[model samples]
Target chain A: MMDVKDRYIIDTIIEKCEGVRDPALIILQNVQEILGYVGKEYLEYVSEKSGYPLVELYGIITFYPQFKLNPPGKNTIKVCQGTACHVRGSDRILGTLEELLKISPGETTENRLFSLESVRCLGCCGLAPTIMINKKTYGRVKPSNLKNILAEYEEVDQYVVE
Target chain B: MMKPRVAFFDFASCEGCQLQVINLEESILDLIDAVDIVSFRETMKEHSDEYDIAFIEGSIVRPMDEERLKKIRSNAKFLIALGDCACTGGVNKLRNLLPVDEVVEKAYGDVYDNKYFEVEPAKAIDEVVDVDFYIRGCPIRKDQLLYYVNRFATTPPHKNLDMRFDVVPKEGEVDARSIIQYNPKKCILCRRCHVVCNEVLNVHTIGISQKGNRSIISTPFGVGLEGNKCIFCGQCLVSCPVGAFSEKSDVNKVSAMLKDPSNFVVFVVDPIAITSFIETLPGSDRDMGAEIGKIITALKEMNAKRVMDFTPYTYLSYAAQGEYIRDNRTMTFSSWCPSVQEYLEKFYPEYQRYTHPETSPANFLLKTIKSKYPEENLKIVLVSPCIAYKTSDAFDGVLTSRELSALFKSNEIDLDLYSCKKVDFDKDIEMERTYIRGVRSDYSYARLILEIAYMSKFHNLDVTLNVTPIEDYVYEFAFDSEEGFFSALLIEDMSKLRKYLSKGIEKYNLVEFYPCLHGCISGGGQVLTNSLETIDKRIAMLKEYKGVTDLKNDFISQVIKAYSQLKEVI
Candidate 1:
């Protein structure tokens, strides 16, 4: 975790969450960015300071699927299951990638190279069976291309991932 | 000369506004030089007799206040309703929907002798007594207060003493008439929105035409504001008076969201909206879109995670929607703008006959983010200019630009020197022009929808994300009038919109809506100062720095990569 200038910053942010003021959301987002996960330590710290119970904080953290308790993968895979891709054999492609990687949806590979998730129809539905790696998108991928796709990430790219 | 006797009184308020008034540092000197602040409990312990002007804050909630206000009105030569509570009753009136006693009890239930204070409906001073030229805004802007007081000082005694207190509808009183009566005679046509749009959004579409009484501020090229270059930013709506402009309401929805713990709340404010909060610096006229981005960044820096941008989605979807509306036989208003709905519902009530509740891209983005994130306790707020949307409650809080600016003052958040810094365009190494350039908002959503549609059709490509039940038209539908076909079928076209849609790429969980002619840069909350002053402030800010790096490009590249990689799995 990035060392905060003082505990007051985190304490102040956590303190404001009880009333559902939106500022808390920003603090959570920034903290998540710096720290891979919203850990129990932070939640407890927030609970102790903000007077909000840890359960409430935990409930909110779990409520948002985008939020996670574990470190994210080096590469997150968001399969486009939008209406268009569903009709274009996107399921088969997902199955192939998951099977090859030996991980279920939402689980990261043992190597921490990949994490799988799904999203609402990206506007580019014509590119059915689309997959987004980090921020770049690829359209019309055949199940056959799964091997080559995973191979690209075999070496670390210096480019920073947003 | 006898000190201009001044007495301050409160009715239905937290007494905070009164405190803020007394807190003015310089005003202490000027006020002491000009007048005597006698009956101020927050400031002075001593009481006073007769006064020239009685500065009254809060609303008339209690029956006793009515008697007290009448005495003040008779005793003083002038009575001025001080803050928004004194002017429009402020947030206190939101509780007017409930019984007056319930509101009182909710605040001080434990007090056994509460019977000493009998309260009625909280009303502006004008509701109870005559009020002279009043200053508006919750907590009130010191500048506006000074302006009014300064002007009062200079005007002749007859004019200065003349107080016109117009009685508006009481709080929570629902009127079926959606149209706000705009008497063109009342407007001076300062064209605050025009300067805001031109300088901020770079969409110089609204202009003044003709001459004298016939002359009016209008959309670019003299087009009907409804179906023209106007992007519906709501700047003009908030800026206009004599009931000239208003927005549809979603306040009920906001209340419901607040009640529900299952919804995570996010509030979206554009960067230009921040201009409402700060003193504009010199030489810093950044593009409305980029400026909004920077504000969102600052908000993020301030730990406002729920505060996000609607500009990106609005830009992406504008072309797609415009093309559909243009070619299709159906009559559709831009869903992004509540003011357009306000205009149609009021001026052309006949058109409201056909108005559809098609959600805008901002709405879409909000829903998507909520569903994707699924906060068991989430409520998304959209801080925007369309006050007509005050009743909508589509999100959680539809904080007006005025309310947003008030937040800065209320929280006493000072704008650091960093905030006043100008747009560093040259620093964006990757992009050609660093500062964002987009049309003003009236038709911003419309333009974006059209652009995306054309782009998608031309590229013959489509993106694949999970397809949720599209409650409204997504940004893929288009109508090709020349082709005699609605051309937005799923395709591989991505050429036309990829570049335009890719402007200011950032990951945001919330999408704000202003739909004003510009964002809140032209909001009612912004100081209506001289154009040269505003321009100078923007310019001065620009002189401070070289510019920012193309971190935006880097973020976009990552977002695209993520999307591309997702394709293989789906």
Candidate 2:
């Protein structure tokens, strides 16, 4: 149930992928980029557009970790586990986030404010023990800072609700 | 100690999966100890709706099936899909190949207005209700079923190692066209069917449609194999290690016909089929004479009116094939393999004139017997190494040597009791012709094509049919004489055939194609094997025992009459 503008963007992505090698995969990628994740409707749409059966499309979605079957939270929290970050205690930070958010890595919080994911590297090895919330990266982060970092997004959600 | 109350239910299935549980003979005691067997409709006279864990077989095909399944699911704490039908919509999905109207007519015979068969596209158990696990295979392997039952008392049940269809699987297999049933529930995803079909046969029919857990061996678009370029070559049936691929059985049909007093069921036993079946059996001497008598004795015990031997007719058949090939003025292939005939008809219809259905000895025998008896009740059943004979329904029933072995096992024929008693097939008529001058094997019959096609044309033509196989499966027959050059190609491999056909097949005036590797003796319906050693062994056994036994005299007279009538020039 997308509006006119989103429909045009998604439709154009599908049309571009038509007749390409591995069209289903390409369309799923392009749609996920625009819509944040390739959900059930997107999978069925891509299947219908590409003519690949549902099982194939569904299999691709489940197989690759990159392709999400559900919409992501408003703010994504990426805890870097790079070699330098691991040395500086990113695991402790990730553990605290998991406890506060009450969701494991790669899962959204119940309130949909933030989603947690542990990435290999954010390419900011100099900024060890870092956690990225949406576009902003909090460097030299401690485990205690996860509460304030997650709370920053929660306040914005509370304001919107008000 | 609370033993889990277990029940068994079946929907659109043979109920053989349920029976497989009981076949766990010694282990049945172990099963009863582990779980309380509450409901098994197939075995017990009574059934209880109340059960903790339900092992259900078969697929959902109608609203009633869906309703019945929901009721079972509600009653049971855990519902496990109990075979290919329940796990992957196995052979039940074969009906989904055709339109509901057409398949209904095929099965129920034109009672379209009936309420009982308000059919829906077949669905697996999970598609209707949540299935906790699956006991896979066509009939779940006895050891695996027992393991699942034992797990109830011992430890946690192993996650269904056989099935991985996390998503809805494609409608399993249509083998209606090619007699080779594919059940994904048993499939280990070996992709042997893909190689045999797409690469070897060049039919390009069966292949993997999806990937990973959702993968299924199917025709394109996951449609059934019914209206495809499948040449009914049961090559896949032999290639399949698991019983995932099997030929459609006609044993029950023949058994029923034999039991009917009004139906005169005449059994026609092929020599090679007997040879292969005997070789498969343990500690059997290579005495073709005694082995055939055993088969005849077994058939007679099964209430078969008359068991006729086809050994002598195999030689008679060679001459008929030779004449047919010689008579064809155009480039064509002469083969007794029905798969070859089907390939010619479906793919190369222009070569239809070259196809030899009239000369096919199996069909000829049935016709000969019918002409003599002129009785509507006579049912001619061919026990042969070929399942493709089922394609035409030419014989009232076509039983593979393996199926005949099953029939024998079921009837409990005393094979050891009837050894070397001088018992032969019915021979009442006398035939004067004996052109059966000990050929090497049936393959030598193809060599006769060049001799008969060339020599009879110009009697002065001194021709020796020299066969130089250009490739493993490609045979080039060339002989030069007073008449021009005589060139013929006998191709056994279907992959090589596509290249040859595309390169122009009109060059060879006497081309013969045997779709199977070594023709009917190594056919789809024989003792289950894909080994060339076994096939060559079977053929060697046939060659060693070629003219040891005699065919029926009445069958011989009819055969000779038909042969001469076909080629009046002879």
Candidate 3:
């Protein structure tokens, strides 16, 4: 599954991270950022290039929460489950997203348009409830406004499709 | 109503799990009555593409194995993984700790590029195809298989087996850190590994920690198996119902040595290892004495330079122990069981001096043969271990019987095709004249040694001895002489050994203690655990070829000289 381009990218990362003490974390962090998710094939390719064992890479991926084993949908939706957010109808917000996307938290839509997940906090708990679509965090997310927020990401999706 | 056409297929395994079906005996008739067995290669001749229920054994490795497994999956309505190999990739996955291409190239040499030989990291059958049911165990329990077959026949198809093993690894449970020795990925928290580690070896290196779903079999030694007093005997490996534990595979290493142009690989097979291998072999002719000869021929066909039968070689140790017994009344600890030596050295250091300090029979043969060969030639041994052989310069590489089976399979050296050849020797040592019996069991090996000592001390082989009855597998033997030169004790139980050590060992000239009743090799995971009947059968077969019950000085002199030369180096 590692194509020539992925090979080149992995090799470049290995070359850049070369000679660093315990470069596994540095290399893997870069890979997950670029590759969206660190899959088995990519981990093996990086392990081979970086001279780390596949098992070690698998350990690092599973140990840290940010490193995903499976590929995420093009857009990841993070709904805050912090105490402040939950007290202020974040359950309604998550339930609304589940209905609209037809997926529970921690599941990707069948079409791979969006992945749903629950986060502990978005730091702007003063906004009462928040959800993140990719990097853009929306403060004070309304259950009804979830459709319009999904439409915003769908625009970019449409642009790429054409 | 038509009978379900049941079938059996093997992938990367010894196919012993399928043979366990044959071990079912009278119940195998009941199994045949229920299903139309159309394609069991182990028990039948006819083959067919048709089958309703397919029992698949072994792991799906290699490109060809994958293709065949996919076909089997496509054809069958219900595909059940038959053993730990088929269910969880078994010992085949040990090779996955290394890269596949390198393993293939090293094992097969020039045939590396061929698609037929191209290997993938070993995977359980479920990894490749949708496995409907799973029956796990190195050789699955025959009664369990029968009960399942009956249940499936009478019930709805929704019963998909105990799918707990297939459950996803919870957050804290996924520890890939020590995946090489212990993978917590597929651990269903059965606590079999924990029990074996705690009770069996009494080495609490691994233990269950945490609570409920997240509980993991964590190592007590902080970092892993490294910090603990782990003997690396691989008892947990063999005892694990799931294929979680495996030693670093020396299969590819040995094959590479065999194929290397500069090195001459000597194959030394223990009778115990041979017995286990033959028992696992599907439809293997168990009754014949010539089967060992056929196995030798088969090893030779795999390009071994000189195939040495290890049974006859044990006479050197017997004679060495025998002569020593005559001179002294104290005991000599055997170095054959590596764990016993390791145990005494680590736990009971005071008794370490009593342990015999000689190269094992395999090393002795290697040393003597290497001396005869040009020193420039690199000679290595692909020897089987009765317990465990941690790699050392003494043995350049050690291979398991399962690995030996894999090599034999890949090379397509069918034992049925090879007519038994004259089993070889070094030509310098003729071992046909020496025969020591009762070596299969602990009691017998002791009796034989005491008999040898009496023959040496009294110069008579016909002296009848006295055996004082103790408990089961424990005994005290004394001759008519008050000097106690030939008086010996043979004890298999470990707890009694501790008790006897307090009582003093010097009362008897020899105290032969072997802890593992079936020998350590079976529990080492390299060799299959054979039924007592099968082990007895294997020993009986060797007895036909190797049974010369006497202590002849002519045979002893030749072997003793080579053995002493081995001692000179140490």
* Number of the top lDDT candidate: 2
lDDT of 2: 0.72
TM-score of chain B of each: 0.38, 0.63, 0.63
TM-scores for chain A over all candidates: 0.77, 0.85, 0.82
Instruction: Point out the higher-scoring one by lDDT: 1 or 2.
Output: 2
Residue-level lDDT tens digits of model 3 in B153-231: 6663574565433335666433434312666666677877666555655555577654566556666313566444555
Give the count of colliding residue pairs in each prediction: 132, 0, 1
Candidate 2 off by > 4 Å: A1-162, B1-178, B284-286, B311-321, B324-328, B427-443, B454-462, B547-562, B565-570
Error of 1 at A134 (Å): 88
DockQ of each two-chain model: 0.01, 0.04, 0.02
Question: Ranking by TM-score, best first?
Answer: 2, 3, 1
TM values, all candidates = 0.32, 0.54, 0.53
lDDT of 2 by residue, B189-287 (tens): 888877877666767667765566657677644446566667877777767777677777787888788888898888888777886788657784558
- lDDT string, candidate 1, B1-570, tens digits: 465777888777888767777677887677667676778888778998767888888887778888988998899888887878888888878888999778778977868366556777778788877777576666676656655555555552343343333423322222223322223444566666555544443334455544454545544223344443334444455545443344443444544454455555566654343444345423444444345444454444443435555444343234335445444555344455554455445434654644444545455456445655565666666665344444454655666544554444444444343353333221101222222322222122333333333343443222321222112222233343454233221111112212322442122111122333233234443434335445345333332221433324333333233323322432
For model 3, the superposed segments whose C-alpha errors exceed 4 Å read A1-162, B1-166, B169-180, B186-189, B214-218, B287-291, B359-363, B412-428, B433-443, B520-526, B530-570
Candidate 3: pairs in clash? B329-B509
Which one wins on DockQ? 2
Of 2 and 3, the candidate ranking higher by DockQ: 2
**What is the descending lDDT order?**
2, 3, 1
